[model samples]
Target chain A: MIIAMASGKGGTGKTTLSVNLAKAFSQPVQLLDCDVEEPNDHLFLGGELLNETIVSVLVPEVDASRCDGCRACSAFCRYNAIIVPGKTALVFPELCHSCGGCIKVCPQNALKEVEQRIGLIRTWRSGGISLLQGQLDVGVASAPPLIRVLKERIEPDRIVILDAPPGTSCPVVTTLRGADLALLVTEPTPFGLHDLTIAVEMVREINLPMAVIVNRMGIGDDRVQRFCQAENIPVIAEIMDDRRIAENYSRGLAAIDHVPGFRAVMIELRDKITALCRKEA
Target chain B: MKIAFSTSGSNLDAPLDSRFGRCASFLIYDLETDQFEIISNLQNLTAAQGAGIQAAETVVRSGAQALITGHCGPKAFKVLSAAGVTVYNAAEGTVHAALNAYKAGQLPPTSSADVEGHWS
Candidate 1:
C-alpha cells in the first residue's frame, strides 16, 4: 500500500511524521521524499548513499534551419513555450511542458525532443527502510516532472510512504497521485485549519481516501479537530507538542529512535494506516 | 512606422498599462496613415505562464515596428529586440500622450529590459 504524507501549510511536520512512520514499520518500507524543492527526509534517516541518478525531462528543441515560419508549433502548444513570430521558431525551455505536441504539430519536422536536466534522485538504505528523495536544481520553475520520475521508482511489494511537498499545488498533486491513502498532517491552529480545508478539498477532488494527523496538539485550539469532525474525516493520530521531539528533529534524529514513547505512537499509527488501507481495498 | 502601446483600454485616450504582458489591450498607431487599431490581450492576460513571450509574439505578428510600455520584462524584451522592434519606455500618461512623446523623440529607447520577468 502507498501512503502519501501531505500538508497544505509548510513546516507542519509532514517530514517528521513520514520519517518516524517509516522507521516504525516492522517490515521493509520504501520512503520517497517527493518534496523535490527541499527534500530533508534523508537528514533524519542517516543511511549509506547507495547511488544517485540524474533526472531529466524531455523538452522541445527547434531546428531553426529547416523550419518554415508556419507558427503551427506555437499554435498547438498550450504552454506557449514555442513561438514563430518571423522566419524561425523560438523555443523557451523553461516554459515547455515536454508534451511533444509542438514537435507533433510541426509541419516541417523542425522540432525534436531533447533531455533537460531538472534534478537528481538519490537512494539510501537505513536498516529495513529504503529512502529515495528528489533534489530539484535551483531556478527550475517546475517540480511535478521530477516528482513524477521519483514516484516511478516505487517498489510494488514493499509498503511505500511518499513524503509530499507542502501546499495543494501541482507538486503536491503529483505526489499524491495513485496513493492508497493520504495522511494529511497539520497543526491545531487557524492557519493550519484554513489550509487543511483547502487540502481536504484537493484530496476529495482526486477521489482519494484521506485521514488527518494533528501534530503539535497542545499549542493551538481545538478548531482543527472540530473542523475535521464536521467534515467527517478521521483524526487517526495526534503527536503531542514536545520540545524534546523538536530538539531531536533539529539534531537530525528520527523521533522513533530518539524520543521516548514516540515509537509506540508510530507503531499505532502504522497499524491504523494498514487497517484503513485494508478496509479501503 | 507602426507602434504598439500597451493600454488599459482600446483608444488613445486610455491610460498606458504599466505591464506589457498582462495589459488589457494594445493600441497600434500608424505614423504614416495617422490611423490606429486596438488588439485585445485577453488571452495573454490570463495565461498561466509565459505571458510576456506570447504578448511579444502578438506585437511582432501585428507588424509593429515599435512597442511603448511602462515596463518590459526580460523575455518580452528579448523577443522584441530579436524581431527588430524598438521598445520605448512609456511615461505615466495616456496612450495619446505617449504617442506624442514618441513622435517628438522625447521617449527614450530602452537598451534592455526595464524590469525582471514576472514583474507585474
Candidate 2:
C-alpha cells in the first residue's frame, strides 16, 4: 500500500505526520520524500547514508563546429531553448524539456544531448524504516522530472509512504497520481480551510481516496471540521496544539520520541490506515 | 526596420499587452513598407514556465530588429540583447501609438531588463 502525505499550504505538518507514520509501522516501510525542494524527513529520522545517486536531466548541447545554422532546431523547439542566431545555435539547458524534437528536426545535426545535474537522491536506513529523499538543486525550475526519478525507486512490495510537496500544482499531482491513499494535513484556521478546499477538490478531481489530518487542532476555529463533515470526508486523526510537541519538532525529534504516549497515537493511526487500505483491497 | 510589439488584438489599433511573455499576440510592423502582420502567441501565453524566453525567441525569429513591450525578464532580455535586437518600454494605448512613439524617438531603449522573471 502507498500512502501520500500532502498539504496545500506550507508549514501545515505534512513532514511531521509522515515521519511519525514511518516510525509507527512495525513492518519494513519505505518512506520516499517527494518534496525535493525542501526535504526535511531526514532531519526527523536521523540515519546513516546508505547510498547516493546523482539525478540529471538530458539537455541539448549545441556543436558549434557544424557547417550551417539552418534555424531548424530553433524553430522546432517549442520551449525556445535552442536559439540559432547568426550562424550558431545557443542552447539554454534550464528551459529544455528533453523532448528531442529539436535534435530530430535539425537537418544540420548540430545538436547533441548532454546530462545536466539537477538534483541528488539519497537513501538511508533507520531501524525498520528505509528512507529515500530527493534534494533538488537551487534555481532548478523543472521538479516533476526529478520527482519522477525518485518515485521510480519505490519498492512495491513494502508499505511505501510518500511525503509530498505543498500546493495543488503539477508537482503535487505528480506525487498523488498512483497513491493508494492521500493523507492531507491542515490546520484549523480560515486560511487552512480555504486551501484545504482546493486541495480536496484537487484530490477528488484526480479520483483518489483521501482523509484529513488536522494538525494544531485547537489553535484555530472548528470551520475545518465542519467543512470536512459537509464534504463527507473522514478526519483520520488530529494532533493537538501542544507547546512541547512544537519544541520537540523544532529540535528534529519526532512526537513519538518526545511527547508521552504520542507513540501509541501514531501506532493507532498506522493501524487505522492499514485497516482502511485493507478494506479498499 | 522590422519591429515587433506585444498586443491584445490582431490589428495595429489593438491595445498593447502589458506582459511580454504571455501576450495574446505579436504585431510585426515593417517601417519601410508601412505594413504589419500579427502572429498568435497562444502557445507560450499559457506556458508553465519560460514564457518570456519563448516569446522573445518568437520576436527574434520574425526577423524583427527591435521590440516594444511592457516588460522583459532577465533571461528573455539576455537572449534578445545577444541577438542584437533593441528592446524598448511599452507605450501607452494601442500598438499604433507605440509605433508612433518609436518613430518620434519618444521611447527609450531599455539598458537592462525592466522586470524580474515570472512577472506575469
Candidate 3:
C-alpha cells in the first residue's frame, strides 16, 4: 500500500506524523521523502545512507562545426532553447525540454543531447524502514524531474509511505497523484483550516481517498474537527501538544518512541487507511 | 506568419494575467497579412503543477513568429528564443490593447537590463 502524507501549509506536522507512524509500523516498509525542495524526514529518522545517485535531465547542445548557416534545428525548436546564427548555434540549456524534435528535424547533425545534473536521489535503510529521499540541488528551480527519479525508485510491493511537499502546488500534486491514500496531517488552527480547505479541494479534484490527522489538537478549537466531519473527511487521530513530547521530538526521537501507547493509534490509522483503499477498489 | 502570445494559461478559457510566471495565457498571434491571429497554447502537461513551464512551452510550441506576454523568466526567454519565437514585453492590461500595440509594433521585443540576470 502506497500511503502518502501531505499538508497544505508547511510545518503543519506532516513530517512529524509521517516519521512517527512509519516507525510504528512493524512490517517492513519503504519511506519516500518526495519533498525534494526541503527534506527533513531524514533528520527525524536518522537512517544510514545506502546509496545516492545524481539525477540529470538531457538538454540539447548545438555543435559549431557544422557548415551551413541554415537554422532548421532552431526553426524546428518550439522552446526557443536554441538560437542558430549563420554558421553556429547557441543553446540555453535550461530552456531545452529534451524534446528531440530539434535533432530529428536538423539538416546538419549540429544538435546533440547533453546531461545537466539537477538533483540527487539517496537511499537509506533504518531499523525496519527503507528510506528514499530526493534532494534538489540549490538554485535549481524545477522539481518534476527529481520527483520522477524518486517515484521511479519505489520498491516492487511494500507498504510505501511518501512524505509529500506542502501546499496544493505542482510538486504536491505530482507526488500524491498516484497515492493509494493520502493522509492530510494538519493542526487545528485558522491557517490550518484555510490551507486544509485548499488541500481538500485539490485532493477532491483528483478524487483521492483521504483522512486528516490533527497534531497539537487541543491547542486549537473544534472548527477543524467540525469542518472535517461536515466534509465527511474522517479525523483519524489527534495528537495533544504535550511539552514532554515536544522536548523528546527536538532530540530526534519519534513520538512513538516517547509514548509507546501511540503505536495502537497508528495501527488503527493504518487499518483505517487499508479499509479506505479496499473500498476504493 | 503565425505568432504565439505568452500567456499564463494554456487556452482561450485560460485565465491570462499575473506576474508573467503565473500569467494565464501566452496568446499566440499569427502575423498573417501583417496582422496578428492567436493560435492555441502548448498542451498543459502540468495541470497538477502551476502553469509556469506549460504556458511557456505553449508559447514556444505554437511556433508563432512573435510572442506577447507581460514578463518572462530568463529560462523561458531562452526557450522561446530557441523556438524561434521573438518575445515582446508588454504590460498587464486588457488583451485587445496588448494585441493592438503589437500590431503597431509599439511593444518592446528587446529584453531590459532587469530581464537579463547573469548576461549583460
Candidate 4:
C-alpha cells in the first residue's frame, strides 16, 4: 500500500511516524521523503547512498542577432513574464515556464534552449527499506523539481510510504496525491489542531481517504480527539510525549527503534492501510 | 515534423479540464498541421509518482523541437534540456491561446523550471 504521511504544520513528527511505519511493516517496504526542501528520513535511517542524479530546468536564451521584432513569443506566454520591444525581446528568468512555444514562434530561430540544474536525487537502501530522497540545492527555492526527481525513483513492489512536507499547498498536494491511503500526522496542541483541520479538509477535497495519527498525544488538551470523534475520523495511533522517544528523534532515530510499542502499533497501522486499500480497490 | 504534446493520461480521458485548474490538459502540438496530439502519460506505472522525467524522456524520444506546458518543475526541465526540447512557462489557458501566442511571437522562447520552494 502507498501511504502518505502528512501534517498541516512542521515539527509534528510526520517524518517520525512515516519512517517507523515503513520499518514496522512485516513485508518489504520503501520510504520516500518527498519533503525536498528539508528531507530528514535519511538522517533518521542513515543508510548508504545508492545513486545520485541532478534534476534540471529548461530555460531560453534569445540570440539577439537572430531575433526579429516578431511578438509571437509574447503572445504565447500566459505568464506575461516576457517583454519584446520593437527590436529586442527580454525574458525574466524566474517566470519562464520552459514550454518551448516561443522557439516555435520565432521565425528567425533566435531562441536556443538551455538547462539549469535545480536539485539532486539520492537513492539509498536500509535493512529492509529502500529510501529515495530529493535534496534541493542549497540556494534553490522550489521543491516541485526535486520532488519530481524523488518520485521518479519509486519502486512499486514494496509498501511505499511518502513523508510529505507540511501544509496543503501545491508541493504537499503533489507529493500526497495518488497514494493508496494518506495518514495525517498531527499533534495535540491548539496550533496542531488548527492546522490539522486545514490538512484534513485539503485531503477530503482531493477525494482521497485519510486517517489521523496524533503524536505527542498527552501534552495537549482533548480537543484534537473531540474534533476527530466529531468528524468520525479514526485516531489510528497516538504517541505520547515520551522523553526517550524525543531524545532518539533529536538524534535522528526512528521512534519505533527506541520505543517499545511503536513497532507493534505500526504493524497494526499497516494492516489498517491494507484493509482500507482492499476496500477501495 | 510530427509533434507530441506531453499529456498526463494515456487516453486523454483521466485528465479532465477544470478539476486541476488545467485548460485542455497538457499536450504536444504538430506545427505542420496545427493539430494537437496528446502524448500518453507513463506515470501510471505505480512506481513513478510524477512523470515529469518520464514525460521529458518521452518527448526527447519523440524528437519534438518546441514544446508547451502550463507549469513544470525544475527536474523535468533538465530532462527535456538533455533531450534538446525548448520549454515555455505559464501557458495554462486554452490551447488556442497558446497557439495564437506562439503565432504572434509573444511568448518567451524558453524558461527554466523553478516553481516551488524558493529559498533566497
- Best-matching candidate per TM-score: 1
Candidate 1 versus the native: TM-score? 0.97
- Model 4 misplaced regions, further than 4 Å: B1-120
Model 2 TM-score, all chains together:
0.85
Ranking by DockQ: 1, 2, 3, 4
Q: How would you order the candidates by TM-score, starting with the best?
A: 1, 2, 3, 4
Worst 10 residues of 2 chain A by lDDT: A78-87
Q: Compose the digit string of candidate 2's lDDT tens values, residues A143-190.
A: 899999999988877999999999999889999988899889999999
Best by lDDT, which number? 1
- Looking at candidate 1 chain B, the ten consecutive residues that score lowest on lDDT are B74-83
Shift of residue B88 alpha carbon in model 1, Å: 1.2
lDDT of candidate model 3 versus the reference = 0.73
Q: Can you tell me which runs of candidate 3 are displaced by over 4 Å?
A: A67-80, A84-87, B1-120
Displacement of residue A226 (Cα, Å) in model 1 is: 2.2
Off by over 4 Å in 1: none
Judged by DockQ, which candidate is best? 1
Worst 10 residues of 2 chain B by lDDT: B45-54
RMSD per model, one decimal: 1.3, 3.2, 7.8, 14.8
Candidate 2, backbone clash total: 0
For candidate 4, write residues A1-281 as lDDT tens digits.
Answer: 67889999888988878888788876778888898888888988878889988888887787989887576776676543344533555665555666778878778888878887878888888888888888887766557766866776667656889999989887898887788788888889999999999999999988788889888877889899999999988887787788888888888888788888767777887787778777876
CAPRI quality level assigned to candidate 3 from its DockQ score: incorrect
**lDDT by residue (tens digit), candidate 1, A1-281:** 99999999999999999999999988999999999999999999999999999999999887888898899998988888888767888888999898889888888998889999999999999999999999999999999999999999998678999999999999999999899999999999999999999999999998999999999989989999999999999999988999999999999999788788999999999999999999998
